[model samples]
Structures are given as C-alpha cells and as structure tokens.
Target: MRSVLAACLLLGLAHTARAEAPLTLRFVAPERYTDAQSRTGSGPTLRTTIGGLERIFRDLAGRTLHPGQSLTVDVLDVDLAGTDLPGAGPTAPRLVTDVTPPRLRLRYALRERGRVVLAAEETVTDINFLLRARPGGSSSLAYERDILAAWFGARIARREPPRG
Candidate 1:
C-alpha cells in the first residue's frame, strides 16, 4: 500500500511539472521575416538567429510566468538591432545607430489554468536601445534579448491586459 501511494504521488508531481511548462513558440513564415538573417556573409545564419530568439523567449517566459501560467507566441517578424554598413566587407560589423533599434512583431496569448487571460498582436521596439544599459553585454542576440525582456516585463510580468 505504501509503494502504491508513493507511485501515485510521483505521477501527480510529474503531471504538475508538465502543466507548468511556460512557453509555446511558433515562427510563422520564417522566410518572410524582416531581418532574421545575417547581414554579414560570415555571420550567423537565419536558422541561428531564429534559434537564439527561441531560447530567449523560453528563458524569459520560464522566469517570469506563474507556475500555472503559460504563454504562446507566434512570431511574425524580426528586425535586429542594427543595419549592416553599406559597402562593408563580409566580416564587417553591423552599424548600431539610434534609429536602428531592435523590433519584434508577434501575436501572443497568455493563459492561466487553460483560460486566456491576455492576448494581443504587438510590435515591440526600443528606439533608445543604444542609450540603455544592457545587462546581457556582448552576448549573442543581446540587443534583441533586451528588447524582448522589456516587452515581457511590461506585458506578462506585470499581468497587464493588452491595451487595445
């Protein structure tokens, strides 16, 4: 009887853990994304950029969401932080200017206990990205990650419903 009870308890715990999984990410028409590919010929490819974004979303949602909450993100477009300098070589760095901030267009649904609490199609950007202090300094997709973090904080962490 003790072993049976323990087995049932373990199964219940496993189910709860699975229920608490945080994020579901979908890339809609990735090939049509605005700037998901590497501008420099020698830099990370489109696949790499998308993969990095996925990791960022998962990490952010995991850390910010409540245990019984989950977020579903459908990525519609991505414009990275900078533009490649014109006539630059294949290995040249991108030009990070005040105007060329990171942008992400996505549709998201935040659910709690299988009920939709918030949903929106949002275009998130940080025009002052160059002026802000980036905590994840020099990391891959750092600028993009920062903007996403800000978006997550405003939209999900605060539990604010969509404005419009």
Candidate 2:
C-alpha cells in the first residue's frame, strides 16, 4: 500500500511539473524602433507593437497557459509601411507612401523556472494588407498586431495544456 501511494504521489508530482504558471512577459528592443518618421503614413513603433503583442499573449495566457509560464521577446527589426522620400531632408516636410504593408522581426523564448521550453526567431509581415480594410477602427497597424498575436498564440497553444 505504501509503494502504491508513493507511485501515485510521484505521478501527481510529474503532472505538476508539466503544469504552467501565469505568463510573465518581457520585451527587449531598440528605442528608435518605435519612432514615427512621417505623419502621412507609418506603421507602429516597436514599443506599440510589443504592447499589442503582450495584450494578445495575456489573453492567450488566461485561456491557455497553466499559471507561471513566461515569455521574453527581443525585437530585432521593424520596417514600417511607406516609402522614404529621396529629396526630403530633415528640415523638409515628411511625405510617405501608405500603400506598403509592414514587417516585424523578433526573437522570443518561452520559459518555466528559468529553463527555456521554446525559442524562436520570426519575421511577421502583412504584404497583402488584408487586415487593413477591416472596419471597427482597425488600422493597418492593428492588422499587423492581430497577425502576430494569432501566430504567436497558435504556437503557444501547441505547448499549452488542453482546455477543459
């Protein structure tokens, strides 16, 4: 009976070991990554993008992660949707073409107890700007944010426990 009890306890401990905790999000990126060059048209800054990403992850965590899991994001690059004018100097008025979509690249790690369970570097883009035209106050930037959120959420879901 004692042996059976020990085995059961061990099993319980194992299950707990795999259980996740509430997600903690950390962002690392360039300060200039979030700057606005032109008022006519430009994508969000690195910070803004990160905020949106975190919001999405927070929602996903509430629905997916166990409780203590954490995500650390390191933003590498940001290419906003617009064209840089060749002759436009710093003193000249900024003019940007708003037809292009944005691109974001970053590296991230999903960890538990300081041990990384998953790590990846991804480049997210909105070439077609499919989400750009969505109504309800959704901008091209919002569309980009949603795309990143969905992609990241899917990846996290794969590692998360099944919802009961």
Candidate 3:
C-alpha cells in the first residue's frame, strides 16, 4: 500500500510540473524598402520592420493566444511613401507630398491543431495620420507604426472572419 501511494504521488507531481506550450509566431517579409519616409522617421529601420512587427505581434499574442494556437504573417508588400500631391519649384516632383498616408499589405493565418482557423489578406491605410505630428520631426513611419499596432491589436482581439 505504501509503494502504491508513493507512485501515485509521484505521478501527480509529474503532471503538476508539466507546463503548457507557448504559441508560436512566424513573420515573413521578403521585400525591402530604402526610400520610405518611415525609414527616415524616428521608429526603426525599414530593413528591420519585420522584426518590429514580430515584436508587436508577440505582445498582442500574449493577450490573445490560447495554448496550441499559432500565427503566421506574410508581408507581401509595404508602401510607406503615402500619396504624393503636386508641389512647387524645380524640385516640385521630389517635394510634392503634403498629405501622404502609409499603406501595408499582408496575409496572415491563425492556426490551431494543424488547421487554419482564421486567415486573411489585409490592406491598411489612413490619411488622417498626416495631420498629426511627431514630437521632434516629420517621420510618417511613427504614425504608421501606431496605426499598425492598433489595427493588429483589434484584429487579434476580435479574431473575426476574413474580409476579402
């Protein structure tokens, strides 16, 4: 009886020691951008944008993921130059962007048990951020990052059906 009780106790301890596996995140951005204003902005390098997005996604996943769930984001393209309007002077063609809004296109999949539970290709853009200003400079990237965080946060929180 004593040996049987000890075995039972050991099994219980082993089960208690086991921890749930963490959700996994995979980010893929094969394209590169050097001229985007965000690269010149105050956030981070455009080359490292994938890393930045991964960090943001991880933070959001912490609150949104359940065990056995995973996410993959494939950034197909990025255009941070926004829309360019007509400008003045000989350099008008170069300096003509008074109201530029960032644009991002990506495909994402949320999976569980080896099946895609939710997936979508999304494009996000906003010109309203142009009116806002950064603390020290005119880097549109900072505003774009904030916009991305909000957009992604809401999507992760809701886990809604795909919208084209």
Residue-level lDDT of model 2, residues 1-164, one tens digit each, is 99999999999998876464455555555555543333323334345556665676567567655545666666666565554454554334223244555666767777766688978877766566654435563443455555565556665656543222
lDDT of 1 by residue, 1-164 (tens): 99999999999999987786778899999898888776556455689889999999998997899877889999999988787665566555567778888889999999888899889998888788877746548765888888889889989999776566
- Model 3's C-alpha root-mean-square deviation from the true structure amounts to 8.6
lDDT (10s digit) by residue, model 3, range 1-164:
99999999999888655433334544344445323323223433454555655565566666666776667776666665443233332222222143655666767777776688778888766667645545654433465566666666656556766455
Residue pairs of candidate 1 with colliding backbone atoms: none
lDDT values, one for every candidate? 0.83, 0.57, 0.57
Q: Which structure among the candidates has the greatest lDDT?
A: 1
TM-score winner between candidates 2 and 3: 3
- TM-score per model over all chains: 0.82, 0.52, 0.54
C-alpha lDDT (0 to 100) for residue 83 of candidate 2? 45
- Model 1 scores a C-alpha lDDT of 0.83
Sort by TM-score, best first: 1, 3, 2
Clashes (backbone N, CA, C under 3 Å), per candidate, total 0, 8, 0
Deviation from native of the Cα of residue 137 in model 1, angstroms: 1.8
